[model samples]
Target: MMIPRMLRCSVLLFLILAVTSCVHTPPLYVNLSQHNPIIDDYKALTNAGLAQRCCPEFPLKDGWLGGDGDVSVPLDATTTLFLFSDSYVGQQNQTKRNVPGTKIIANTVAIQSCKWEDESEINYFWNRMYTSNPRPVFEPKKHGNKFWVNDAFLLEGKLYVLLEEIGEKENAAPDDVFNFTQVGYTMAKIDNPYDTPLTWNIDYLPLPGFQHPQTGISCLTRHKEYVYFFINNNDRVQQLVRKAVTDFEDMDHGFEYFARDRSWQSGIETADMDTLFTGFRCTTVKYHSAVKKWVMIKDIQFKTNEIKMRCSPELTGPWSEERVVYTIPETTPGNEHYHENNFCYLPRECTQNYNSKSCEMVMTYDVNNFDLSYVINHELIYTPRVITIYLPVEESGGPEE
Candidate 1:
């Protein structure tokens, strides 16, 4: 009898565990506050000392700004920055967070938007898309539950936004509650996303078949004919790829199930971004320069658990080990401001290339407190930060598998 694939994965995991349960690395406790002073000299030349603790100031007084995720796209003669955020009333009804506006200065574009989409708004938008009597392919649950629709990208002069729906039954049982997380994509035609409301030119398709894929979506650059997306399945943070199916029919709406055998070679620890202290929110992006290369950055939970960077040339098998890029010092509440979800680096044309050896990167991350018991309270307070990381190309070119 043929062994089932799922069981085979279990057996393989057992064997790998049975053989090498002994090897281990010394635990390193990373404190963001008492960091080494000399590391300051190691700052990248382009955005020197720019990676400081920052809290995005919400533009409106009534608005409480949090859950900030962003995508930067180049269209026409300029680059437009679209920042999608969770705008709502804070605890105690002290303030409100509304979607702000986009700011363009010279060649740099920055969007200070706090409002993106709420549960009702998305449901209304999705409902109107189908215009059918039968229920549509996607719909948001009517509870006060929330879903993320923030991952947006630019392809072929159109803006593609990945909408994530996480649902819960209106009156779910204490144990039998339902949480559905799937990725659906939509596109807009405006040269800049902030130029118009996201709902104006949006049309969507639901992505299917991946085990409990988290609401977070990663767009790992397009290579020739393939566009890779890294999604966290069942919070295990599995990596999967899909070729660009631009044809309306072929690309309409379908996804293949990625078995364990086809998993990304790396993983974040099972703990939250704070406890497991290794891998929690896993996301990736490819840096194509003189030679093609891919880099993966994950939240490495340590004392405060820092977000670390690792690089690999090829997606399948053989990945360069993990390395620490920037550890948020304890004095600075880096983790307090940056959470998981997604991150994108500022491209070459936008910054100083005086030195061919290095380039500055501005990273966007989901920010909030770690404890789940504090879910509702923490959600509103979560603030996103854009930090700069200097990528040293020469040192990172250490062979490829």
Candidate 2:
């Protein structure tokens, strides 16, 4: 067999290469569970008194009051951040927005002391260098005050926020409701989200083609080794895109969409991606370990006057239809609380207020009015409607063996 040393070396090299090719790293499996979120059994979280921290009820400092777009994110165990859009901060004593003075800023932020015992403990912040003229915390680097900031999530202790860039129509008036176009999206990175928003440093990263007029960025949730982003794909459908935990700085690539084949694939082609939910909103979609279901709370505007809950076994498959968790009393025409112009949207999940053992969780919806003045005069129209959701022991569906 040792006919020639050179020939023997060549034979050994071939065998080693064959063995190496056969041995490869196994694919990663992100462990998750799923169950039905029973909406039939639920009620308002009246005890939490989350309402105490809302609107004119909370004392105003520097004319800083409350606003809509209640995009709440739990930074850590005990604190939560509220990112708002089209907020009112003007004359605290003036009941009417047109009177003493009222300025509707593009955005503002607040820090909540999530202690249900004292739900009133929350402080709002924005740049007030000119006390009478406050600027948004992350003011647009451009001229327009149309940065409708949405969906924020934390990964590796850093916060990432999605700011929608809106552009006005060439000949349209300033106050026209439908005169704006979604120009683009920018993701802001905050290395110190724990500190006051004013003290934190932000790096704005521009993202193109992510702005589809019909579908827009809404929810940003992290599950296992990946952070998943869901968009209200044309109001009635929801689409998803995700990146690895190690891929934050370069969001330009490494995106995986929930494909039509029910498999995760690279790219953003709508034909390639699958719609998971029948309806969507700019809300949180997360895994509740206690209930073992990936749950999302949302309300499709103009569809119905109810905030609903939907769930799925996996983050990207066979999602259950929504069950009405709370019928929005403020939007119901005949209800005493209802105003002719009153409406509600954007049902958000408050993770910090979640109670694990009993499968109890808190959700909030942004109340608004078609007539802008109604929000200012009514006081409660532009605030949040907080409710409590309690799930059953084991409704049905999957355990994902």
Candidate 3:
């Protein structure tokens, strides 16, 4: 049968559409193994070298703190680490005395150095906080001279630092400890952080609603309109996720809880957290543009705790269930301790110039001298090892595949 030209064209189009509908997009199987980390422990600093001894001159009568506590934010081409340390009074079999509040010792290092071996090259922007806060600020006599700053971020080229302050009491009983812990915010402008100004635009905000008061432990990152804070609420599950609605640079805006009505564990997974729905931090690179995915690393605590990672298509996720990407070596007694670990992605070329689907990650976390105390005690601490994990080259799609 001879068909009209228009009718024949229509029939051919229909057949083509039918075949296209049946074809499935090939899954993107990224070969993560091909990419290797630049090296392990590019710049390793131990407590023995960084820790300051307990002395009467300092706030703590007999105490020490390891400078491992830092929050880093990437600026221009370098990563600025806001170093935080606190001194404690109680040392050995004795009642606790007054301690130094969180004091800031500012420093900046190129993110690239994080992949190389040069400790001396790194610059410490010390007493930079004193410059950030130009006001002749002095702690009230009751609280003593102590400040605890943790978890810092940079937004719009301005440094946003968060800290907690503890207060003391006078004419009070020996056993009576005044419960005074407040979260404060401060800002600094790094025209050239190498030549860091000696003052900051400092301010304090009240710490609210807690069975046990906590401190910020890790770097906070921006996801869309929200800033995510990773904290330890002084409980079994030491790490808790919190959020602030405004941009980190805006001091006027206060933080609102993620899911006001729900509890931590149950509420987060179920999407009850908030309207700005997303979860991240704990892992180094939360938002990776190459893969178009958000990676979340959770620290689970039991008798012996471990770290794990999960991925989602978007920052606000219906997250893929966590996979045990790596486990801390249980070779020694109680190897897994605190929740602090590191994760960083290899540059794109390392993945052979692959697109988002062909991306790869290379991460390193220090297991030796896992904490500041390792230095304070003057102990030959564990040699924190850096472990690199390569995700398989197959696309991770749909949970439990």
Best by lDDT: 2
| Candidate 3: stretches off by over 4 Å | 1-65, 78-82, 86-120, 128-149, 164-194, 197-219, 229-285, 300-305, 334-386, 391-393, 396-401
Q: Candidate 1 lDDT, tens digit per residue, 151-254?
A: 44455444555545544445555654133333343322333333323233444444443224442344444445445555554444444544453642244343
lDDT value for model 1: 0.34
Top-down TM-score ranking = 2, 1, 3
How does each model score on TM-score? 0.51, 0.78, 0.47
Every model: Cα RMSD to truth: 17.2, 18.9, 18.4
* Residue range 40-131, candidate 2, lDDT tens digits: 11121222333233211233443565576777765443445778877778653434454455777888887655334333355666777325
RMSD of 2: 18.9
Alpha-carbon runs more than 4 Å astray in model 2 = 1-62, 91-99, 114-120, 170-175, 396-401
Worst 10 residues of 3 by lDDT: 11-20
Model 3: per-residue lDDT, tens digit, 35-128?
2221111111111111121100111111222232333333322122333333221222222222234222222211211211222122222332
How displaced is residue 381 in candidate 3, in Å?
2.9
